[model samples]
Target: MQRLLPQHVRAATFDRRRWRGLDPEQVYAYLDRLADELERLTRDLCTANTEGERIRQALRQWQSRHTDCRHTQVAPNSRWHR
Candidate 1:
């Protein structure tokens, strides 16, 4: 099945010029549900992006500290000193 995008949801139209056309109320309700789903998805995406950035920053800080320890020859446990 093809997935519907936000634009597609917004642009949906039902035939109303015929006696057998779809009910307008039902169509509008479905559109409302689609909008709600789109909003929820957007929020989830933003939360995921924020968490990913946080992890990247933590990794960078750890790498910097590790590099500093390697270059300084004076790590806290100094196995060479023992």
Candidate 2:
């Protein structure tokens, strides 16, 4: 099943009952609040994903640049250590 999104909440409709129906204004207000919150959370999630990707890329680059150095070992009797 597809997950409900902010747009879905905003576009939701309900049938009205002539005898005992819910107040349309109240329903709309609640939907608006829910949609706004969903929108904010979605935005935050996107930003977090972008930042995570950036960090991962940086880490990969750093590892690539340092992999060789990390594998190199220093000798105790090297010329520079004399």
Candidate 3:
């Protein structure tokens, strides 16, 4: 429901319960907090996905280039070799 529920719907919906059930206000508060976190995490995930795609594209472009292969592929005994 997190993905399907709109922010307005989340804000407006209320749970039905018996006399001994949990407090409606508490449930609403908790749901509101959860909804806020869900929104934040969704945005973060999209940003991370976008950045990952950009990095992948850059790596592909770099791999396609053929100039200066020696510097990029140094020998095992080179200064930058591990």
Candidate 4:
């Protein structure tokens, strides 16, 4: 799975060389927008992670319930059993 950077950090650090010429007010506004975007992204990521975990747990449970181990045992007339 691909990992995503938090939006605020990505925005702040985006094109750092070009950002050097930006005025203070613009910088502050960018940071504010970044912060909001980051918060929303974080919440979404958490929800997705939780849902993934739940799906994984459910798959595990279903697999365990349906798996058959009887085929692994020796047959009644098998020489190895004697």
- Using lDDT as the measure, the top candidate is 2
- The list of candidate 3 runs beyond 4 A from truth reads 1-15, 67-82
lDDT of 2 at 16: 89
Question: lDDT per prediction?
Answer: 0.83, 0.94, 0.77, 0.74
lDDT of 3 at 52: 100
- Candidate 2 local lDDT, residue 51: 100
lDDT assessment of candidate 3? 0.77
| Winner of 1 and 4 under TM-score | 1
Worst ten in a row by lDDT for model 4: 7-16
Report RMSD for candidate 1.
4.6
Q: What TM-score does candidate 3 get on C-alpha atoms?
A: 0.65
- For TM-score, candidate 1 versus 2, the one ahead is 2
**What is the model-wide C-alpha lDDT for candidate 2?**
0.94
How do the residues 1-82 of candidate 4 rate in per-residue lDDT, one tens digit apiece? 6555565354554343664565756777777777778789889989999999999999999889867754578888999786
Q: List the residue pairs that clash in candidate 1.
A: none
What digit string (tens of lDDT, one per residue) describes model 2 on residues 15-61?
Answer: 98888989999999999999999999999999999999999999999
Best of the two (1, 3) by lDDT: 1
lDDT of 2 at 81: 56
| Model 4: CA > 4 A from native | 1-21, 69-82
| Candidates ranked, most accurate by TM-score first | 2, 3, 1, 4
Ranking by lDDT: 2, 1, 3, 4
What digit string (tens of lDDT, one per residue) describes model 1 on residues 1-82? 8766666787787778666867898888899799779978978988999999999999999998799677766566777765
Estimate the lDDT of model 4.
Answer: 0.74
For all predictions, the C-alpha RMSD in Å is: 4.6, 3.2, 4.9, 8.8
Tell me the number of clashing residue pairs for each predicted model: 0, 0, 0, 0
